[model samples]
Target: MAPSIRLSPAARSLFDEPLAIAVQGLGPRQQVTLRTSLRDETGELFQASARYQAGDDGRLDLARCPALPGGSFSGLEPMGLLWALQPQKPFWRLVKRDVQSPFLLQLEVFEGHGERPGRLLAQAQHERAFLRDGVRRVPVREGRIRATLFLPPGEDTFPGIIDIHGFGGGLLEARASLLANHGFATLALAYYQFEDLPQKPKELHLEYFEEAVNYMLQHPQVKGPGVGLLGFSKGAEVSLAMAAFLKNIMAVASLNAPVAATCIPFSYKDKIIPAATSYEHKAKTTSSKFLDYSDVLDDPFQAPGNQSLIPLEKAEAQFLFIVGQDDHVVKSEYYATEVCKLMQAQGKGNFQILSYPGTGHCIDPPFFPLYPIGSHPVFHKRAVLGGELRAYSKAQVHAWSQVQAFFKKYL
Candidate 1:
């Protein structure tokens, strides 16, 4: 038989899983160049290639063979091509898409690693599924909340969720879009920095969120006497407050969120929750580009006019707090601990926390690189967001499943 390429599961896979590659019908020790390419959100193609030699049996299986030199990755790691692929520049990263779309991994084989005249050997492609098929996204412009609703395909009512983003300040559709693919009707809602919303985090009102809840509840495809809330960072606090003060919020999943109201003052009809006061630690930044926030994490209750603690005693929603122990952004693990203590003291039994020791602040969907530090998008200051690569990746998969199961039971 002529040389050909084959995939273990055959041309389809989940984004979280790996695909096995094999080349067959080559002469023993013959050099073969393997290449793969995937496009990003902006339509830029990110490519990676490697050279390998067929074994004594006239075949090379990625499962049994190692990557050889002369391509993008010069290491001996198996599956190195999947993670080590680079953009045109060293500083640029592979693009990650959060929309409901399948990423195509186009693969090709060449006789050798030739710059211009390499003879083609074999070709194949695999479809990696992330978002589920038939998921529909509708732009939300109703009321004060500017958002987008991702409704899974089908006429049957699905559990509804309102997804809120952090201090970065725009309507992020990724998380909500992915959730919709997992069988939930999700709304990625924005409080600021897009369209007519607030330019910054100021004068936040719970009523705007209430309007969002109403919108989700009124959707014909949403089955809800109540809905779920999913939020990150600053948005996590909003989710907490909504679950505490608003009616019909049955569940909430908060990722790297603070137990105390922090960053911005939160106001309801006649009351205001003071934000926790923060101060930068100048001494810790001498060795690294990211500033350490260890000093500002001092007990918020000790701060003057500190009224940021949400009234958890009033919340009826079931809660799942996902925190990273090494998160340097807002001391998520510490805040999660404090919140758990408060809930225990108040005799609340519907709350639980899943803390990953080595993860970071941005526990996004799986397969994204571990961003150790970056300039805060809104604040424009370099700061640490801690995580070891493998640990953070594991946290993402676990948390994604946990969110679905939690909402399935409570929403």
Candidate 2:
């Protein structure tokens, strides 16, 4: 027989009052039972019992007794469950029933402070762009590309949109899919598989995206004349650089993206360009080295260095800069200000800039669960405000509408 485990006084206080639990671990293929008792400041409030079964593989199976006050303890869903777990908070506990191998067990005292029913209003919104059909894949350059082309469902030809995903993440994300649902012929290009890790930015190539754009223009569903470019984070920077250097791009929208250059070295024609920039800019200030990526590689279009390497002044496409005020990830306002300054200096007035307050880096459409609010893991010193995923604000929705209108007028 193994020893039983109990909850600490501090841990019990988190459950709204005081709670006690006794857990025993059975050997593999055996089962152990648990009894949970709860009390308020006054006295006993409720009592419950649960059963735990030990599988042959040493995994403990937890089942709640139906007679318990909370009914059952079903686990959380996959994607939405991220908000349910507390990051960097000691909100969970583990109890062991065995001494040697110590059969492990985890318990969460649910006082209902997390994202569960009766908490926040988080819903998923569904909208489709192509009135007639769903997404289809097209073969291009010996490889297949997944794309969603949306027309007005009439005989009219509409402007096209090519959406690029950010670093490491995949194309199946809500951002690209939602844009396609909104009547844009969106091509969510998967630079890397979600299951497969991506190489560092320095190893990326610009020719692949150029090839993607060319393929989109050749598609029967896409409007042949030109197409708009939309990207977030690293993808946004790529879109901006492509618009600057590529002749076919008609418009670009960059969202909360870093303008730093990459580290890969490549030759555009015969000239070698550096990979990324070396500048160290605070949230609102830019150093002279900010655009200098020439030291690393000759191809400035690769990553960090692409900021100053691509000549936006020579770009023919209209641009839109969308940023969140509370975006500590990339310092949205700083990029917006710098880009606007450069555009103005080049006598380019065909660009628009919009910002939203109380919003974090990923301004997902309304209904998605918001990120957990706190300092970012990458930039631990900086504050990150995470909460229920925010949908496009009325103002943001209006801005998106304007973006569509702008592309329609230009592209």
Candidate 3:
């Protein structure tokens, strides 16, 4: 009998869900190479390979067998083939530009762990879909709101949540789609780098975000006394500003963003949250030839600089600060800690922080490969988004669960 690759369930599955992998009908104790390959919407190839041996029973279950070194990853990672995948192109991050489509994965088994695997004995294909079958993807084009709303299937109404991507711009619906699968009617909102919006806007206004919050609260499929905000990088900073001034905001989940308005100033109704002085002149060049932005943004704790700090004590929403300790892109952990002190001074305890050491910037949904470095979305220059792959992957999974639980409990 020929060896065959098998996926535990049907080939169709959510991008965030994990599937079992195994190779059957192989010779007892046979050494083989397992490779997984897939192309993003852009036609860029991403692939991973692992070496393993069948048990005495002639079955190789990834859940039971530990992967050997000298491959993409090693040890007992059942879903390593998916997460260990790296792009063939340099500095290319795997992004799901169109959530309406699925990423098809090709899995193959070969005879040995050579530069070229000896024989292609087994092959299987799987589709990692972004949009769930029952979930509805609706494009939002209300006044001043350029976004996509994702609602769970059926007559049931889900809690409302707003998801914002980084300063890099564009509407990223993948995260919102995943959250909608778990019963949150999420809106992936875009502020810039999108249709008719400027690529390099000088100022960010919270009024635009306020419109999104109101839109969510008023949505028929969305349930809310208030809505939650989930954001990354500059998006997180915007969330913080909205939380501070906007009404009916139940929670804010911030990922690796500044505590104070920086890079770009944020403006509300009448006043402005002044941003720290720019210090691009002070940025250090990393060994990888990318910029290390760890110290690029000025500190918010010092005098005059505190003028840019957001006063979250005025906010009615609970806060969840997810920090990556080794994040060279920004001082995430430091910001989280100082904010805690400031909140304590004001006698407010509406914030919960989850800090992960060795984790870097860019924490996406679970099982996605780690993006150690990429061009800064705002700068268009290569920058270090530091992290150890395994640690960052683990952080991504745990942080996602924590965020869901936080939203469920509070929002």
Candidate 4:
């Protein structure tokens, strides 16, 4: 019989769930290469492979067998094929533009561990989904707000939350869709770079975001006297500002964001917060040829730059700051530490910081590939997004839960 790959429980599962992989009908003690590949909406291919040996019983269980050295990874990571995937195109990130469709994952078994696979022995495919059955994808276009609202399968109104993606924004619904499946009414809000929105706005206005917040509070399906805010990078910075200046923000989960306004100024009625820092001068070229943006922003605690700091002390909401210690895109640990210090000094302990060592920027859901490096989507320049593969993957998983729990508690 030909060696066959078996994916247990279900071939179709949510992206966050784990699966068991095993090979049957292989020769005893046979060496093989296991490879996995998938393409994104833009046709960018991401792939991963590992060397392995079959057991004496003519079978190989990924959970039991350790992957050999000199492949994408080495060790007994059953989900490594999914987590260790790297893009063939340099600096391209894997983001699901359409949550309605799953990423079709192709898996193959090769006869030997050569630089190139000796021969394809077996193959299989799996579907990694973002949205669960019964989840509703609702497009929201109410009064100057462009967004997508995700509703879990039920007639009940749930705790409401807003999800914001970072710079180079279009409407991103993947994270919001997945969060709704877990029982929250999640809204993926777009600030710019979409239908009718400006390509480059000189300043981002908080009044615009406040419109989104008010929409969530007024949503019939969104149970709220207040709503929760979840954001990453520039999005997180915006979330921080909303929590500080806006009402009806019950909680905030910020991922690798700055405490000071960055790149662009922020304005509210009668007030304007000037830009704090930029990538100029500080965005240095690394030895590896990739740009390291870790020091691009000016010091937020010092003269002039300190003026741009978000007055987070004024926020009444509970806060969760998720910091990636090894992030090369920003000084996440430093920013988070200073925020905590400032909060404590103000006699406010409404915040908690979770620092993940060896984790980098671009933290997403579990089982997604390691985005240790990428170019700025807007800037279109190469960047060294620091993180160990295993550590980054683990941090993504843990931080996701922490965000959910924090929201569930306060919202």
Candidate 5:
């Protein structure tokens, strides 16, 4: 019989879940090349191939077989299939194409390469998840904070989260929706702008976010002694502050975020959290002639607001800070380090820090290519985001997994 390929989860696989691939019906000890490819929304094609030799039974099991030479990666990395792909443009670009859409991965095994190529050994296609099926997307509009809720499929309660976005306002549904697929009840909170909200970032009230926290705790789909906060950039600052100021926050995860409040003023019951000291320096312009703030970042200690850090000592929630050393928008590593130091100085032990080198400011979910340089979506200017593709990709994967594990353990 001809060789055939089979996938364990043959129908659909979650973005963060692994799939097992097995090849059977091959000649004893046959040699073959397994090729994987996918196309992005922009019609860019990415492909990767690794040579392999089947066992005496004419079967190749990805779980046990080590890939031979002639591919982007040399050995077995758990998620090698993702990073191993040769990009026509960049991995980040491919991920950006349509994060909300499913990705179809085409796989084929060929007997050989070049002109002496043998017959096709096996071939298969599988739908990989960015947003998995069975997830319930609910609109949140009951309180002061307007947000969207994502509940994992089924009636089982899950650890809850209040997700916050950065300077570019508007509820970023991608991250929360993706996390929900991984078994969390997530609320993507919109602070300013978007859907009958404030037109711009200004006079922000922390009460709105507090209301979001209350909403998450009260959600039937949410399992909570306390919920968690997942935030990026300015949202990260809010996460830190919320864990310190609010009640019932079991944990906080800040991604490439800031130490001080940013852009707009944050107030809760007449208490104000001042914005960071920001400096605007021109780097370059995008094709649309927008100025890029590649070289400029908030200058810590340059303003009185920087002195008013979130009281880490008061925060009872566990903390995880994911920092990119090469982040161009903020000194993420420095801020994360200082936060750790302050926490330690205050005898707080509930914090973990992971800093990745060669990574940039806007670190998204896993497998997304390194957008080392790009035009800011809101600022509308091109600038260096800072990250090498390989390191950034690896960081994204590790950070994403770590976050899920963290929530499972603490929330």
Candidate 6:
């Protein structure tokens, strides 16, 4: 009998790997009957399997084995039995498979984990929308890109919003979805996934975003010749950059996004720009990645001084900066102060900033619980784990209402 098999570290990292039972010390033409049983974390027997034959190589193929509940058996590569299990949820066990054998074989167990954080973060980045309502997709640039057209229920063309998503996250979020439901033509633009990934941050491409804005303005559903730009996190930074460089943009709203220029390597019209702007301590949690710009005004790689990239002073459109005071991911205070200063310097009056106290990053709309508060990587800078589940405050609601009013008048 072969020793019990276990998962290797590399295999474990892949998110999905099967559990197996190996049989050895057999001769050709020797038939070996095995009996197996599988159980979940509750210690209940979920599966019972019976037989297998020894191959010419003195190895038994147990591929096609019965799967326990919530588990699937496969004969695919890494040729072994597989069980689908969730660790955060429960545990499962596989029992003996050999018959007429005195030895009791115990298959090692593995659990299924919940969705990846990166995936969840991406999903949370976009608001959900119904197919029959609000917005529709139109092909652009030979279908290389798509233009989303948001239309109000009434025949009247409403103001348009060009939505941009954060870094490493794609379109399809609650922000745009809800905005479209509320009568705004929201175009969630995909600058990266619509085409190839850019080579670096300085080299990052904005041509697609620019085209998307043009497309929105030309759409019949749009009420005006231009549209507003609403961005979150990296998207917010992009919004700022676009407003700085693009003349057609009419308004901008930056939500809980970093004010610093990004550091992804990309080519901007054949120029090689280093990716050194966005920095995060991988060893730390999201809240622990809190950024402060007070010290780096002179550093080009830091915030504050990067203002040349964003003409906050020359912005012609109305601007709203929405941030959470307790947000650790991006220093809301730093961005608020810097943007206010820029607006003041430029004599720009059509701008406002609102901050929600006791709120963390990624403030959901009062449905979900407030997370990462007092944990290891707290953004609030306090050790208050599980601080209350304050998803949205009255102040946030008022601020949102104000946003709608502002856009209604400006967009």
Give candidate 6 regions above 4 Å deviation. Answer: 1-144, 194-202, 265-309, 365-388, 391-396
Give candidate 3's error at residue 347 in angstroms: 1.1
Which lDDT tens digits does candidate 6 get at residues 315-396? 6777888887766556655676676776787666877888776665554332222343332222223332221222343434
Cα miss at 390, model 2 (Å)?
A: 6.6
TM-score of each: 0.83, 0.55, 0.98, 0.96, 0.81, 0.56
Query: For model 1, how does the per-residue alpha-carbon lDDT over 226-266 read when each residue is reduced to its tens digit?
Result: 99999988899899999888899999999988777777888
Better of 2 and 3 by lDDT: 3
C-alpha positional error of residue 273 in candidate 1 after TM-score superposition, expressed in Å: 0.7
Q: For each candidate in the order shown, give its overall lDDT on alpha carbons.
A: 0.78, 0.48, 0.88, 0.88, 0.77, 0.49
Cα misplacement distance, residue 295 of candidate 5 (Å): 5.2
Best by TM-score: 3
* TM-score, candidate number 6: 0.56
Using TM-score as the yardstick, the better of models 1 and 5 is 1
TM-score of 5: 0.81
Candidate 3 weakest lDDT stretch, 10 residues: 296-305
Could you give candidate 3's per-residue lDDT for residues 21-64 as a string of tens digits?
Answer: 99999999999999999999889999999999999988999999
Question: In model 4, how large is the Cα lDDT of residue 114?
Answer: 94
Worst lDDT 10-window in candidate 1: 88-97
The total of clashing pairs for model 6 equals 32
lDDT of 4 by residue, 1-411 (tens): 889999975589888878789999999999999999999998999999999999998899999999999899999999899899999997677888899999999999999889988888999999989999999999988888999999999898899999998898799888899898899999999998998777788999999999998888887888878999999999999999998899999999999998888887899998888888575667788888888878777778766447799999999999999989988877888998988898999999999999999898888888777777787543567788888888888898899888888888898
Off by over 4 Å in 1: 1-39, 42-131, 281-283, 301-305
